[model samples]
Target: MKKRIIAVLMSFVAVLTLSACTETVVELNTVSMFGGTDANRVVYESTIYAFENEHNIRVKDKSQSSDEEWKSTVISNFNTGNEPDVLQFFTGETAKPFVDAGLVMSIEDIRKEYPDYAKNIDDSVLGTHSVPTTGFVEGIFVNLDHFKSNEAKAYLDKDVWTWDEFKALCAKLVEDNADVEGYKPIAYGQNIPHYWIDHLVAAQLGPDYYNVIKGAEGEDKLTNALLKLSEIKDYLSYDETEEFSSQAFLDGKYTFQLDGSWFGGRIELENITVYPFPVVNEEYGSPLLSGFTSGFYITKKAWDNPKKRDLAVKFVEAMTSRETLTKFVTYGGGFAADSEAKPQNETKVQEALRLVSPRADFVVLPLGDASVAGTYAGLVEVQASFVNNQADTAKAAVKTYIEGQTD
Candidate 1:
């Protein structure tokens, strides 16, 4: 009778062990700029699937297109202590608040525990600023089909466009497409004018554009760039909220759009291609707006959770691995943060690299990312006294904003 009792107790213990093993799925929450129709999102999801299969962790992805509204929500979440476990955010002023609040984990801090935390990311590219950086580039996305239909096909044959040539093309596009229903020459809007500002300063300053953030000797160059914004005002369109809509471009109503390399993933059509924004400083040989600017950041919330801490680290490790960053570059996320990844096919991002690399005498980061907060604000503040007002007012407004910047 005692032997039978012992056997029954052993069986009960075995059942309890089985139930515990079955209940070991950890749900990790993450956020990023990978939602919408971005092709990179496919890779991101696939990685998450592989991670779940290899480990007992399930990722709760809450990603969306990164815009002003999305950024506001992220900041609000962190402020209220409802932030995600892992976050993919940018560097510069965008990251300053989070870093200052001690809400995110640094690669340095993580490495003390796991030496190879971000081994895939190089020391040179991991921005020592408040947050680390991956990389991104801005350029012009051209609808080749639209160009062909409008008889502007010949305009794209050149290696690099002179300022005169580029301006002429813009004028021609407006004239030819004015009567076409639902058609527009360019997809620029004052609501989002930084790319225009960025390329113009790059063209005006040549190699000196990078110093604008430092309050360097380029006030005249900046003024000239802002004046060009005035010159091109006729080509811009705004929605009800004075915001730029890339939807027009997506709807195939606009011929050209000044956008970033990351935007390439949104194109599913084969007729699209990319080029450097036109150059005014011919002596500078066509400057291209391209570089590393943002990256993945691990938050402190996950670090404090005993069960979530290691899982979050592993998730981040998989996300920032060399394999993933390479996929990011090849799939049109931007320039490779750690490797020279070329797409297997001729993606628009890869084509932009081919055309821009040899032709561009200089590569520059956007003023928003390159400059201090106040300087970038001065350059990009659309509500300021100068924007969309007049050529003289625009120039004066930008000059005041940039020149008046404090440390």
Candidate 2:
């Protein structure tokens, strides 16, 4: 009986030791475009750090800039069987390659195992991607301080702000700041002119940015839109050195800066306000660029692995949580993916939402985002034509966009 008792105690102790020693530690491989020079880098790192502290998962992040070359490399990794366990990438037509290949997992299939995953973000927001919005909108970021005077303030108060009204306001601003040498009413970088291009195209067509109804080379509407944009070039700064430099705008050199919602996060400017671009076309209301065009994706490789599957899902869930999404809005100036997520009070984030949140009924995205993959890069060429006073060659830039698929 004593020997039997000793054996039982030893077995119980062994079981206890085993239970205490056993733990799940997953090394999740992840990739994102939020690495270098990303506005949300600080918040993104903090979220990942917090997730690590709470879970037994250690992230092996391999993030890079989402440039064309990097995008090509992402597809290369998938082809070479080196895709990350979790990825943040563009959805829709951009991701159609990998998605069609059945390499990325879907929310519908994931629901079979984890029924309650990603239920926080609304269905309309989720659409077919089943991921929270991690995208931004483009708009006019104006220094309200520049407009505190009666002359500019009246423009804002006007019930109908048309292209004519906009031109007059620009002329007035130039006259007021006559002492400021070479002062431009609109600030933008010659290198990055896509923001204005998107709105110009949208004003030509409609606000349905998700599907650019019918835009192609030699289209008269597109030509007219580009022509209009160039017509107002006298008010636009053609600075190659400063790409919407916040410092330049803050210095009161430029009254209006064209930028994305992401540009205004945690900015210290006191009298900054965001307003919709003028309805230049009159036929179509000004198209405001905003909302999610991309999302966190889980690879089939991660889902197939018994160890990485749950950890991957948990990581995505944490990344897209209300708290994290609030950071995305408050710090990153992105649209809040979670309904509970709210921006910091009195921030431009709130101002941006005030400008576009009314259109929450639709899943609107940037006008350029709907273009075929690899075609957007060609826009840089298109911009050069107008910026250099060569409006006649703008159509040639559009022709550069080969009507072919690129992963």
Candidate 3:
């Protein structure tokens, strides 16, 4: 009888142990575009660690380093019905196919269910990711030390300036800093000159010109914009490669850099500033190039799993929380979708947030992506030739490029 009692007790203990093991086996799979850089990776890993600690759940992180690779991986996974529980992807038109296929959960419904999670996040930003074709802003990064050293602080200090005044200031900076070896008024990548010229054309003309630029009458406008940008080619620090230009900007060799907000954390500059491309038309405010929205999306697989759904939501909440988003902004130097998350220790990002107007005319740059108006390979090539002192061929090149696009 004593031996029977001992066996029964041992069986009971074994059953309890099996139940505990089953309870602790909950797992959440995740993938993101944040694995490319050290700063981004550190922040992402810390967030994951905190979430895992708090929830006592296993997080299977499958993040990819390359943006192109990440996109391909996610798309393939989604199509194969093997996508992770949570995904970080380009929001806007890029996400539409996934949404249409019912792969993404309704974040709106999630917000309704978890009001605490949605609190303080900007409605516009949330909407941008939730809806189709909604976008975000792009602007320039300035080296504050270079600006102050060249006595061109007034251009940024003042609220507004005309096209001519902006040009004169750039010219003056080049002339004033001519004695400084390797110094240039502007630093920009050869591969992305079209990105800079797009902003210039939008500022000089208006956002409407983007739609009109492919027409026959738009040839003159395109030529004029090209000529205006070409005027500063002599004042620009020309590098054989894009990476060199970015390095030159960080080394204080250039006063102005036309790049998106991501540039803030990429460089180690102590004093940097950010501004919208200055306005040329007084009737319109600064022309902002609206880029694709990028954010997290909950996969249908995660949402359908009753056991893991709430845990996934909690992870999203932790990732998008003001504290986490603030860390991203402070370290990565990009605007956060969380409205209440203020940037700390990043002056350039702070100034950019302050300067960018909600009321500004937001236009999409014609990057070859699906979100923008359309892509013209010839447009980029012609701009390059114009900047390289082949100005005489630029107008004809521009015409040919537009014609090809129209055809």
Candidate 4:
């Protein structure tokens, strides 16, 4: 009777062990900007799958297509105390609100724990994500094949071109391509006037000009930059829509278009080269308007739970690893935050890096973050008015807008 009782107890223990070994899956919630294009979707899904397989954690990805929409969703989720365990959001001013609200978890502990992983990422790039003041880099995409085929090649032979030379090249393209049905010298959209104004100002005034903007000299510089940008309106197509401008540039109807490196992934074209915006002042070299870091953050909710926190940190590390960042650059066409993962040669990203490397000091934070709050929006409005020829008194109109900012 004793032997039989012992045997029954052993059998029960074996069954319990088996049940524990085969327990249900652990699920983690994550949100990111990964659903926009097919390529981006593939890269993100594959990376997530790898993480899940390695970590034994299932991720419930709730990624959004549009950046604006993703930002709104994250803010709403945070307001309702439903923030995801891991969030992929923009860094800097865009992220300040969340950080101030105590929703974001500082990954300093995680970095200390995984020194090897942290070592690979550029401190400057990571600072942009963490410190809120260190800016991010943005590159311009150019259709190199179009330029090589056109007379504009001579002016673009060097990596850096003077503002006058760039304008002359545009004029030449417009004059030479006059008979080419839909050809335009350059791509322009009234919708993103802020981009035009920002690049022009950065090129003219250097990165530290934001401090100058608080006084008289900065105001003069801003006016000069705006006036320079206004001159390019003559070379742009009369169409006011971004869709029309982007399609025209992609279709090879325009010789040049100023945009972020992500533009490379969205368009299907070959021989597209990336370059810095032409500098108005040669002394400033070529300033790349970069000042927005978009990265992943772990939520406070996730950090409070040990199990969830481990998984979330692991996922963030994996997603930002050199291999994964390379994949991001491959599919997304932006500079990888991981400095060690060098971009492939003869690629658009490589060309951009080479062009911008000489004038690294010129990299500046976004106008909104560096200058007054809500300045970018107001500048955008001013740019549109100037481009539309509505600003009969350009300097006065811009000055009025600048003075109106409460910051």
lDDT of each: 0.69, 0.71, 0.68, 0.68
For lDDT, candidate 2 versus 3, the one ahead is: 2
How well does candidate 2 match the true structure in TM-score terms?
0.58
Which regions of candidate 1 are displaced past 4 Å? Answer: 1-134, 149-151, 210-218, 240-244, 293-333, 337-340, 344-355, 383-392
Instruction: Give the local distance difference test score of model 1.
Output: 0.69
Over all chains combined, what TM-score does candidate 3 have? 0.61
Candidate 3 lDDT, 210-310, residue by residue in tens = 55676557777777766776667777777766788888888888887777655665767777766667776776657766553667778878888998889
Which segments of model 2 are wrong by more than 4 Å? 5-86, 89-96, 106-137, 145-194, 202-218, 230-254, 260-269, 276-294, 299-314, 326-407
In terms of lDDT, the poorest run of 10 residues in model 1 is 124-133
TM-score, each model?
0.54, 0.58, 0.61, 0.60
- Expressed as tens digits, the lDDT of each residue in 47-147 for candidate 2 is 78888889856888988879998889888899899999999987766788789889989899988899988888755467454485455656677776656
- RMSD each, Å: 9.1, 6.9, 6.9, 7.0
Error of 4 at 403 (Å): 4.3
Model 3 CA lDDT for position 150? 32
Please report how far candidate 3 places residue 174 from its true position, in Å. Answer: 13
On TM-score, the leading prediction is 3
Which pairs clash (backbone N, Cα, C closer than 3 Å) in model 3?
none
Which candidate would rank higher by TM-score, 1 or 3?
Answer: 3
Cα-based lDDT at residue 304, candidate 4 = 83
lDDT of 4 by residue, 90-169 (tens): 77667887888888776575566555544555543454234221123665567765554346777666766777888888
**Superposed Cα deviation of residue 33, candidate 2 (Å):** 7.1
Shift in Å, residue 380, candidate 1: 2.7
